[model samples]
Target: MISRRAASPKRSTPRLPHLAGSAFRSRSASPLALNVMTIITRFLSLAVLTLHCVAFAAGCTADETSTTTTLSTSSSADASESTKESRVLRHAVFFSFKESSSPEEIDAVAKAFEQLPSKIDSIVDFDWGVNNSPEGLDDGFTHCFLLSFADEAGRAEYLPHPAHKEFGDTLRPHMEDVFVIDYWGDANEVTDAKSDDETELKHAVFFKFKDDASEEDVAKVEQAFAELPNKIDSITDFEWGTNNSPEKHDDGFTHCFMVTFADEAGRETYLPHPDHEAFVELLKPVLDKARVLDFTTK
Candidate 1:
């Protein structure tokens, strides 16, 4: 819900039209009677002016009240959308299959995992793909699945949901080691899958800072990092947030930044851009360790 902080409307003094002085004076009238008549005329004119002001102010108040109501309604809608977006809980899973598991078995597990969002109503976003990065940083994990939930309650429901449990059963036999990390963040930067072969690239960066790094240094890094898109045109979408998960799988990483590019060439330009190099210079001092993962959307 939108909270209104608007001030009360101030009352304004009405500007009265000037009246001709001689019009209220009668030439043939007695002095006493003229004086009384003048007083009575002035009173009536003043009363008319006050009435006109009241009527005009009332109409203005009515119109202004209607406009405020419309603005408030629109703000409430925006607030609702923001709240929905903010509550997104990202569940990231990296799976490594056992040596004995065949490609067909792994493919079956992947298919079953992909069906979870359709089976569960709480799942807001879902994407899964095999590791296709040229960088050898993926370790042994080959498959990555990203799932989004609207809230913790949605995740709670999903944890024991029948379909999820069934998928877990399917994955249990084939999986050699599984690494799961959950964080409440904005994952809307990642796009959905398409039926066509065309796929976009996502650059995911995780940062672990030195223990002595101050909040100011981190804020500076964040501010400078946010300015990169303005300097480079290849960035399609960008979002970053601090880690908010209680899960110990984070491995001391606290910040995640995801940048989207239209193609690998776009990423190539972004990597070599002088602006990116400068930003990296600012980040290098406080950054103790970093991991980068690049993948194409499925």
Candidate 2:
């Protein structure tokens, strides 16, 4: 009944010597020291931020340089490929059949020559036609056959082909004269604009430069010939190159130019064209022999 009051709980203050000392020292610090420390801290933060920005900018520049280099290389490669695709080796053949050969025999010879392309894989394209130009400029040639190849190697393969040799054997009997000229030219596709139906007149011009003609003279002649299409409205297409055939059958003809027209009217217009006449005058001095054959595509 008379229980003693529970002993009162002891009240004790917690020890904080380290915290108290630090707080007292901070409060006693000079304003100049505090400002100096704040300035140093801000300067260090800015320096780190500047370094990060510099690193990021350098990385971006390197990436951009790499991308630009790659694009340049790709563009150059594409341009080279386009140039290669546009060029080809052309083998042009002109024939004047013997008077003794009948039409049926000539037709057989034609059919036999046509078959060589199918047999020889090197022949990329083949086309033939009889002379139809009223200009009387074909020099006794009656038939024109144009064969296309990818390069000199393709032409090399074609020249010695067994099928081509057989075709030659078949053609030699009735062939009064055979003119072969090979050159490099544009690989123009026969599209609607240049289709056989529209642009069929082919004016094949072959040249044998004089021994006295300098390289520069020949170059001038070649340049003048190339400019004909630009000067004459009737010229639908024009391509030219030097002969590079290994067959030794070109008979000294060095350069070949193939000019296309829509019809005989176009040919008629082109022949008397002032530009063409001027070109001929320019060519006269350096030219040794010139062979021109005009035909409509069959």
Candidate 3:
């Protein structure tokens, strides 16, 4: 695979996460509107590591079949440069409840979050998630979602997506408390994240290697690192890859990875798994240079 530079980080908000009702008990919306936003603020408090993905973008440019199956597994950041900035920013939606809800209820909300894709607005990207921790995060909430749009107008249209509002109404009875936090994020801050909190889950991470690393050699390192997720069950979502081009760098930096867990414990479980230990061993050899960044959404 030919290497291309990584794409620039477009300033965007984080997506709200969606957890499965089956995953945990649902919390009722708290009496305080600010309570929901506060939790998200706590999440934004974590850094979101951006992996340079111009190479991943190049990889994505291949034929249709490869794009979905092969490229999905590509190692490193998958950011694409987005220009024509407008009122819309990347939207990160993070919410948690008090307990687990039924699968049907979970599906209802999942569908609500899903409506943004074709909500008749300027939206161009959307993704959602369910909390996957095995237990311990006794909180009633169970999901988080991240949605991206071309501009703020797209976001405005989304608020009343009739469908989304319906989702809130549908979730009202099953929910104990709903939390939300919205942040205006920049690519530079995301890629160069730092943090002091050891309890929250890490968002984005950055790494840079010398210019001499050939595309094939880079591919080998990724192949070895990709298997890290296989080690355990606590990992809710895992995405890791490298920056394709040096030219795309906001700085000379070039690679990064991101992992999301149900809570801090899920992340902690994955850290010591035997397979993860091996992954560290494999990565250390190819890692001529590296840096680890961790952050939350707050």
Best by lDDT: 2
- Residue 109's lDDT within candidate 1 is 96
> Best-fitting candidate, measured by TM-score?
2
Candidate 1 per-residue lDDT, tens place, 1-298, comes to: 2344336565688754354476345455567877887799899999999999999999999999999999999999999888776557877777889999999999999999988889999998876777766656666778877788878888888988999989989999989877556766664543444566767787777788999999999999989998898989999877777776654667777887777788989998998899999999999999998766677777
TM-score of each: 0.66, 0.73, 0.34
lDDT of 2 by residue, 1-298 (tens): 3354346565587654364544435755568877876788899999999999999999999999999999999999999989988888888888999999999999999899888877998888887888876656677989999988887788878877888888889988999987788877787742224454543788888888899999999999988888888889999889888877666778788898889888888988998899999999999999898888887776
lDDT of 3 by residue, 1-298 (tens): 2234335555577654354552123354344645766666666654332233555666657666676666665532232224233222445444444356676876776676677566545555544556444433313345655555554566677666776677668667656544333323333322334353423454443344546767777676666555665657776555553433212322334554556565666767876778877766755644555433233332
For all candidates, the clash counts are: 0, 0, 79
TM-score of 3: 0.34
Model 3, residue 142: displacement in angstroms? Answer: 1.4
Candidate 1 stretches with Cα past 4 Å from truth are 1-87, 183-198
User: How many Å off is the CA of 115 in candidate 1?
Assistant: 1.5
| Candidate 1 whole-model C-alpha lDDT, 0 to 1 | 0.80
Query: What ranking of all candidate models by TM-score puts the best one first?
Result: 2, 1, 3
**Steric clash pairs (candidate 2):** none
Candidate 3: regions farther than 4 A off: 1-88, 97-101, 133-140, 185-298
